[model samples]
Target: MAGRFTGKRALVTGGGRGIGRAIVERLAAEDAAVVVADVDLAHARSAAEALRDKGFTVEARTLDVGDPASFASFDERLDVLVANAGIQTFAPASELTVADWDRVLDVNARGTLLTLQLAARCLREGGAAVTVASIQALLPNALSANYAASKAAVLSLTKSFAAELAPRGIRVNAVAPGRIDTALSDFGSEQVGRITGQDAAEALQRRLSTNPLGRIGRPDEVAAAVAFLASDDASYITGECVNVCGGDVMA
Candidate 1:
């Protein structure tokens, strides 16, 4: 594993925390020169610093995934790109505001579009791209209208990019995680509890129940899937979405 990415240069958006940070750690651990990008420059710098301290080749940068200009500023060169930057909000369909929908889509959907566009141009032949979608992309809940739709768009984009980039030997794939143990997931769980009149504990269990494993997923678990997809081991894999949700949304 250490030499799998020995000379590779990888870029991960939203690599500041949660699942994104896990991805950064995984890639760096495998000996890649990883760049951690986030809108929150401080968090990005902190994550990169910690990894650097671990003797991994890591750097930090600022990125607003929703901004085309931000994407334009990134140098068009890299071996791997993980489109993991996204925001989630919870609200019933009836109460969903245009602002909320736009914000979510702008980051989750439009951002991914921009990310893939960057990858298409930046990634050399044999490069790989992995997007962080969500299980909600396939299974929508009462409060996931906006968030789910955004992730769904990501899945579609993953396939489209895969198809278009195949001739160049670039692979594109996605991971749909369910009830992952991250701050964003916790926020969604709490919001669900408030909407369903369940207490925090009950709501958490409710979320867990959807997964056959009866447990929340770990960031590292999702990261592992992403790493595999982005590695040469999956050279023949493209236009595919891997659900890392412990049997949730089996389709």
Candidate 2:
């Protein structure tokens, strides 16, 4: 039997590692021709090569989602787009620098917009775009004001794009992951340690304690939600933000 994405072509930004890599792997496992797009060419090439070794149809491409010129070189007619490239910085409101704010928003918000715009231009009718947002958009951490605000924008953008693209037979949705075990989360954990004078592992543990599941989530778990939204399984689902936060954001 053929896989769900046997004939489909998918691209995932930041697909070199972490949640983005998991999404690429999952889609490839379903037989999609996957493009691992990342600013870090080394990671992208390594990921693509590993998947190819496993007999998956995968390739690597360099993408700086914040740059429109980068999209010009991406000429594929895509069936699925996973906008997962993002950066986070933790600072109190009083201490946050303008450069930090710009960097976070540039990658997390403007980058997402660029990805969606390119996807809209190249995606065939009935295509899908899934953006990786954050539970902080809803929970609102004081230390992550910039990150939260950028992701909130992403959530809003998803809805607006879903409405605008519905007539064109394209679906747009978002996945808000919480406390996932990835390098990004490790960075956040280290920041928490600096703020709280705790070890990184202890800081991470304390953060995970707040989750109803009593543990941090895995990248693959979030990828599963993205896969559902991208596949025919969620054909009727659009303009929604699915929270993969281990029940952290119940609303």
Error of 1 at 18 (Å): 0.2
Residue 153 alpha-carbon offset, candidate 2, angstroms: 0.8
Candidate 1 global lDDT: 0.92
lDDT for 204 (candidate 2) = 74
| Pairs of residues at least 3 apart in sequence or in different chains that clash in candidate 1 | none
- What does candidate 1's lDDT look like per residue over 1-251, in tens digits? 66778889999999999999999999999988999999999999999999999899999999999999997678758999999999988888999999999999999999999999999989988999999998889875668699989999999999999999999999999999988889887787678888878887787886677668989889999999999999988989999999999998787
- Cα deviation at 148, candidate 1, in Å, is 0.6
Model 2 scores a TM of: 0.97
Poorly placed runs, candidate 2 (over 4 Å): none
lDDT of 2 by residue, 1-251 (tens): 13989899999999999999999999999999999999999999999999999999999999999888888888779999999999999888778899999999999999999998988898899999999999889975788799999999999989989998999999999999998989888888889778868899976777678879998899999999999999999999999999999998897
